[model samples]
Target: MLIKKIKRRIYNLFHPIQGELWCLHRVLNEKSVFDENKDLEISPDYLETKIKHYKANNFDFISIDDVYSKRLSEFRYCWQKKFINITFDDGFEDIYNNAYPILKKYNIPFTIYLSTDFVDRKPLIWWLVLERIVLTKENVVLSSGVIYTCPDIISKRSVFKQLCDLIYNEPDNPADTFRRLFSNYVSYFEEKTANTLTWEQILEMCDSGFCTIGSHTVTHPVLTRQQENEVRREIEESKRIIEKKLQQEVLHFSYPYSFWNEQVQDIVLESGYKTAAMGYGGSCRYNKDNVYKLPRVYLVEEST
Candidate 1:
């Protein structure tokens, strides 16, 4: 905890502009509820209060599209300006019903990155799989050589972060380790709670003139895990689906989970995307930057 505080302080000192604050799962009316058996209960009302605070303070809330467009240029034109871009990951229906109106009212431009598979109701996401075990099982053991029990579930966020860190920092076959862990533990959520965006819903949002849709790959795989051929297929296929559905060229891609390596970066450029967003926390700079591997800030409820 002390290390994290120090890191944040250091980041604030060097990158003081607050260039972009990317947000995920911003639901407006729903309230957070704890469930012994479920991984998460979202609170839309709680999110709204944060949004209100940001607005009241006059923070510049930017969308992913804005980052690729105006904000990118702004960083070049004036590097010292305080700017913050808001981006939503995974196409959630609540983003349309709950977050959109608020953004519209505030006139905040944003980007929504979609995992094409979930749009079609594909099975569980890998991270959610870990979440299932953490949330539902009494005592779970991971193939990654980690053990977590239900009592530990009270610290769900911290547990998840630790699991992710283990996978990321593993010296040998991290990809395989993560895949084994996910495959061994994930189960589907209750049908009613399944959240995904439908084709018609996506079209409506595109037509609403409020959002810019970007590719999050078809299956939401960790790019660093897949073979080069597989990674290329994921990026290319997702662009094709998004363009065909929305009739707009899908130029931007957000790395699934914002995790990637050199090979992944090569695949993104080779697959023909203009810009690819990573989940890394940083501000954008002009001229001396790589367009394909752009960094983004992750916004939490507390940060707002």
Candidate 2:
């Protein structure tokens, strides 16, 4: 973490962020109920603090569009004027439920990279599925006679990571591989309670002039894990679907789970995203930077 902060500062020195993008996942409504992944969420109060901090710090809050369009010829060593662009990945409904009002109140311009499948309800998000399966039940047996038990939170977390790696290593259809394992332990899992943002909610935000929705891909698979053709299809299909559904040009793409490579970057450009955000944590002079691999810093409140 310290190393990353150093690198971010170093990168910012050269490609000073006229409009730097900071990424977040969810802003939690209930701390206890949605407590499975605190790493992915922050209280709305904390988010409010962050907004107020930037406001007081003389930072200009700008949109991703502004980064690409307005701020090109302004890199300096003594960078006095800084900008913050907010982005959220995974399309959590909590952003609409909790974060949006605060952001709207502050008049912040932010973008959401929507995982279309999570919103569409075709397949379950595998990580969430794994968390539930491991946490809610103590002794678990797989269909293949593999025995697993998570007697405590630490054990459960470790088990979840193991399952995550197993799923990630699958050569074909990781989602299906996860589904088969999850189905074996189905009774312990409840239906997904924290729903994704609906089209109605998204449209309302779009009309409000504060929200910009971008594609995070259908099924939210790791792009590098799939075949070449499938990778292209994921890129093209997601952009096409969002534009068709939202009636807005989905001009930006964020690689699902911040996973991308040379091939993935090319596919994103070919599919016509004006900019693609990645989470390697740095800022770039966006004048004519590599739009396909725009680096973004993950924003979480510092621990006291």
Candidate 3:
């Protein structure tokens, strides 16, 4: 903790502004890892405890609306006091099923960034595919014309990182690389295996007035891999779909994979969003510049 504080102080020296801090996903139920016996769990009780700590520490719990509100009256209270905003990503069903109740109990507002593809029941995320194939299968053939065979257990992590580096760190068309990776592994999983929030659940949350919806993109493509036209379509099409369904304008976005460059930022602005969240870690202050590329802290179970 002391090291982290020192790091934050060092960062502040260079960056000056404390960007937004957020918790990505707060699951209410116990979820299974590859090994069912080693389940991942996050209970309401645990979250409540964390919230108590946040409040005691004087951190502001903010939502998407709070970030982009033209009227700063409510925010002024936090801004003057130095509170942290809370946000969730990937529009997980648990956000509706579990997290919402806790937020309401505390009257805390939050923003949920949705990936339209998953909301529409697209296949699993690419990383999940890598996990399944690498852990469950002995050999895998990808549509990208690459073949992968699992290494010894001792070397699995390094091997997986190597594969990711080859695909994601390439100078070639990043979109094509991701597409190839997806086509290769997505075929292995059934639709039911993919976790996603239903449209009804989203509407329910909207009506509850405890949460607001924003875009993560239609297909959750890495923006840096795509051309300007493709990037524009991803942003504009996602906002259009969410707006039509919710009967409310969608003005915020979270980039898929948290990958963005200046070109992608231009596309996001052109898409008419008032603000966008990045996976990069930081805090948000009212007077900070670049509202479009707002940084958010990711809360993982390990960290908690």
Best by TM-score: 2
Q: Taking the tens digit of each residue's C-alpha lDDT, what string does model 3 give over 149-186?
A: 66565455555666667767866554457556657555
Candidate number that wins on lDDT, 2 or 3 = 2
Model 1, 37-58: lDDT tens digits are 1222235565566668767776
TM-score of each: 0.73, 0.86, 0.78
Candidate-wise lDDT, in order: 0.67, 0.77, 0.68
lDDT of 3 at 275: 84
Predicted structure 2, TM vs. truth: 0.86
Candidate 2, residue 175: Cα displacement in angstroms equals 2.6
Going through the candidates in order, what is the number of backbone clashes in each?
Answer: 9, 0, 9
The lowest-lDDT stretch of 10 consecutive residues in candidate 3 is 32-41
Q: Model 3 segments beyond 4 Å from truth?
A: 1-19, 26-46, 70-79, 141-153, 171-187
What shift in Å separates residue 125 of candidate 1 from its native position after superposition?
2.4
Worst 10 residues of 1 by lDDT: 32-41
